[model samples]
Target: FALIHSRWTRRVTLLKRALSEIGIDPRRVHLEWISANEGAKFQRTVSWYVNEIKRLGPSPVAEVVDGQA
Candidate 1:
C-alpha cells in the first residue's frame, strides 16, 4: 500500500512492472485517489478496492486469492 499522492503518479507503470515481475498477467487495472486528510476518501477507497477484488472473481496466486476471499 502507498499514500495516495505518491501512489497515483506511479500507479500504471508500477502495476505494469509489478505484474510483469511477478509473472502475473493482469486482465485489468484500477487506480484510485485518496488524500491523507480525507478519512471518508480512505474508507471509500478501501471499500471500492474490496468490491473490485470481489468482482475480479479470483487471482491465480493462491495465497492472494485465499486472502481476499
Candidate 2:
C-alpha cells in the first residue's frame, strides 16, 4: 500500500492509471490512507501486503533483474 495523505488521493489514482497503461497490474499497487498515529493499522496493512505478495510468489521484475526469466 502506498500510504499517502487524503489530499493526494487524486494523484495516487492518476499514478495507478499510468502504471496500468504501462502493463503493470494495478492491483499490485494499493493506495491506502493511514495517519501518523495509526500504528496498528500500519502493522495490519503491512502484514496483509506481505501475505499477498507471498501468495503471488516472486515478482517478474525481480526475475528479470536476476536473469532468471
**Could you tally the backbone clashes for each prediction?**
0, 0
User: Over the full model, what C-alpha lDDT does candidate 1 score relative to the true structure?
Assistant: 0.70
Indicate which candidate wins on lDDT: 2
Candidate 1 minimal-lDDT segment of 10 residues: 25-34
Question: With candidate 1 superimposed using the best TM-score fit, by how many Å does residue 11's alpha carbon deviate from the native?
Answer: 6.1
Q: Any runs in candidate 2 off by more than 4 Å, and if so which? A: 1-11, 14-23
Q: lDDT (0-100) at residue 45 of candidate 2?
A: 96
Clash list (residue pairs), candidate 2: none
Q: State the number of backbone clashes in model 1.
A: 0
Per-residue lDDT of model 2, residues 1-69, tens digit only: 445465478777888798789766556677676789999999999999888878777676777789987
Task: Note the residue pairs that clash in candidate 1.
Answer: none
List model 1 lDDT by residue over 1-69, tens digit each.
Answer: 457566675777688678867866553465656567999988887788788778877566875768852
For candidate 2, the per-residue lDDT at 5 reads: 66
